[model samples]
Target: MTIACILVILPFCLALAAFSDLFTMTIPNRISAILLAAFIVVAPLAGFGMGEISLHIAAAAVVFVVCFCLFAASVMGGGDAKLLTASAVWFGLDASLVDFLVYVSIFGGLLTLAVLLLRRQENAILASGIPVPQLLLTAKKIPYGIAIAMGGFAAYPSSPLMEAAFRATFVTTA
Candidate 1:
């Protein structure tokens, strides 16, 4: 049961957020809520102690502060900020968190570049009836949730909770 939760929750949430942002230009609050709530429930089952869980919450707080500043500056959408903040808890303040952030940066840059290139060909694509999401072609804001999701998938295995879950699953199964 714990292994199932660990395997499904974060990845499913991230993927859903990415697709929702891609097509609708918004991520629903429920995705973030589910992620945060699931972590609260599953962290202990995965063998994280109080201190480690505190660190995870601290990471989320730190990410929230940074994301809040970006939202205030109009540099990031509210949904994006919330998603990043919620996702940060899985990594805590460890090297995995650093890896997650780095992946986010790289993916964000690449996604931005791809979006820009697509926009440059927007007129042609529009004429050709390729059926891309209209928001992808016209929105001023990038769907940063896509980058966040990509980064989350890339770095999630290194997260401590995931490692603990893996160990637990292997020990039980073996």
Candidate 2:
């Protein structure tokens, strides 16, 4: 049951964040809070040692610091920073963390380009009677939460928590 919850919650939260950002241009604080809180509760139950948990916390801290700087510089949104930090906790200090960051950067660039292109076609879209979300059409900000969520999903299968869950499932089945 715990393993199921752990597996479900991460992707569920990521989906929520992505959808919210896509439609509303905001990733709710509650989504980030839930992610952080769930990881704290679930990691130990999934067989993470104290040292591993500490490293996860450290990963989050490092991400938070970098994201905070980006936020301060107005290069990233506050909600995006929080979401990225929370997601980092799941990856911990591992190669998966690097993969997550790389995926996010790549996805972010792609998303930005797509949004920019879409914005350029806003007038044509409106003239064609297609309803588009005002946030997507008019907002100068890119919904970076989409990229973060994508990165989380891309990296999640290789995360320690997911590996533990898989091992537990295999052990039970065997």
Candidate 3:
């Protein structure tokens, strides 16, 4: 039951952040809060040891510091920083964290290019009958939460927390 809840919560929150950013160009603070709170509550229940949990917290702290600097410089939005930090907690200080960062950077760059191209064609899109979100067409900021969410989902399957959950669910006594 706990594993099921853990699996559901993280993906659900990631999806929410992506969709919210797609529609509004903003990731609600509540989504980041839920992610951080859920990690705090579920990591232990999922049988993570103190050392592992501490590593996860450390990873989140490092991510938060870097993201905070980015936000301070106006290179990224505050909500994107919070979401990235919270999501980093699941990866811990391991190869998975590196994977998440790499995926985020790649996806973020691709998303930026796509958005820039779309913005270049905004007039044609507006003239067409197809409807698009106004924020997507007009906002100068890229909806980076979508890229972050994509990176989160991409890295989640290999994350320590998910590995622990898989073991708890599948490992059985003979």
Candidate 4:
């Protein structure tokens, strides 16, 4: 029970840290290291056993390779790639890479929309003779940890909830 709780909470907290870093365009190594360490500890406990664990590790490796390639092409940040790979360690094979990528795309779209709207507002203010910062010129890059965190949050813990409910239902029979 305690392990389950830790597994659930730690990722959520790390997601928040990631979000903050993404917002500020800074990926704090401390937070990234902590997340990686947590996965190293928690993966074995997730009970897929050794072969399954290897598969999960492979999934993470794939994520690393794919995302790193994107980063190298200048399509994504290195931090985002590392964070996604670390997230894959926890996600495992049950969660398809396609779905993970979908979640990221959806979240990225939302973030882009929000920033665009904010930029528009800034433009309007400047046009109306109101003092405003040059948002287009001075806007900091979105850290992207926010989107990764969102994906991780969506991927986590609903499985455990379902498992618990299923166990309760079969308790008397078992």
Candidate 5:
């Protein structure tokens, strides 16, 4: 069950947010809400001590503050902020958290460049009917949720929750 949570829930939420943002330029609030709620429930069952859970909460709180500031500055969308904060809880305050953020930054930069290129060729793309998400070419903002999801995926394997869940699910008792 823990394994399923680690594997299925997070990935599903990320993918949904990514696709939604890709199409609509907005991530539904429910995805972030579900992520934080599921982590709160599953972290304990996965054997995270109170101290560890507190750190995870603390990590999310810190991310919330930063994301809030970014949103306030109009540097990021509110949905992106919420989703990033929720995702941070899975990594807690550790190297995996850093890795997740790093991957987000890297993917964000690449995604930005790609979006700019796509927008530049928007007229040709529309003429060719290459079947890209319309918002991808028309929207002024980048769908940052895609980068967040990509980062979540890249860093998920090393997250403490997954590391422990893996041990619980796969390590032989003998």
Candidate 6:
């Protein structure tokens, strides 16, 4: 239970900071460092034993490599990639990590759509309020930290109620 709490809270806090920094275009090293350290410490703890420890390490490596590739393509900010990799390392091949990432993607897509709509609204408001065309030239970057937090929240229900519900429905269908 304690570990589960840590797993949920740590990501949410880091994500809040990240979202703030992303909007301001500043990346703090402290939060990123803590995330990295936490992973190194917790991965072994999450493991069942020696055999599972190896899997954790492997998951970390996989996440790192994937982040590196995203960074190389410039699709992701360096800080974003770093934090994501650190979170994945901490999670260490767990189902929770899978759920977290899946929700992250879903939330990210929603965020993008909202940002686009906001951009359009901002353009219309600015156009009517100001005479300058250059004011529209600046594009706002979406702060992704909030999306991460949303993902964490969506995944953090501790009860096995979802699983039980699924089973109940499955029995009905059968």
Give per-model TM-scores: 0.98, 0.98, 0.97, 0.74, 0.97, 0.67
**Candidate 4, 72-119: lDDT as tens digits:** 899888777777787676666664555666677788788777766766
- The alpha-carbon lDDT assigned to residue 128 of candidate 1 equals 97
Candidate 6 structure quality by residue, lDDT tens digits, 51-168? 6656656766787798799879977767666666655544556686688788879988987797666567776757688442332234455556656667756764531222333444
- As for candidate 2, its clashing pairs are none
Q: Residue 131's C-alpha lDDT in candidate 1?
A: 90
Please estimate how well model 5 matches the true structure, expressed as its whole-model Cα lDDT. 0.95
Which is the better candidate, 1 or 3, if ranked by TM-score? 1
* Model 5 per-residue lDDT tens digits across residues 91-129: 999999999999999999999999999999999999998
Tens digits of per-residue lDDT for model 2, 34-67: 9999999998888899999999999999999999
TM-score: the better of candidates 3 and 6? 3
* Per-residue lDDT of 149 in model 6: 62
Cα lDDT tens digits, model 3, 1-174, are 778877888889999999999999999999999999999999989998899899999999999999999999999999999999999998999999999999999999999999999889999999995688989989889999999999988999999888988888788521
Residue pairs in candidate 3 whose N, alpha carbon or C atoms collide under 3 angstroms: none
lDDT by residue (111-139, candidate 1, tens digit) is 99999999999999999999999999999
Candidate 1: residue 38 Cα off by (Å): 0.5
Go through the candidates in order and give each one's C-alpha lDDT: 0.95, 0.94, 0.92, 0.64, 0.95, 0.60
RMSD of each: 0.8, 0.8, 1.1, 4.5, 1.0, 7.6
Residue 99 accuracy (lDDT) in model 3 = 99
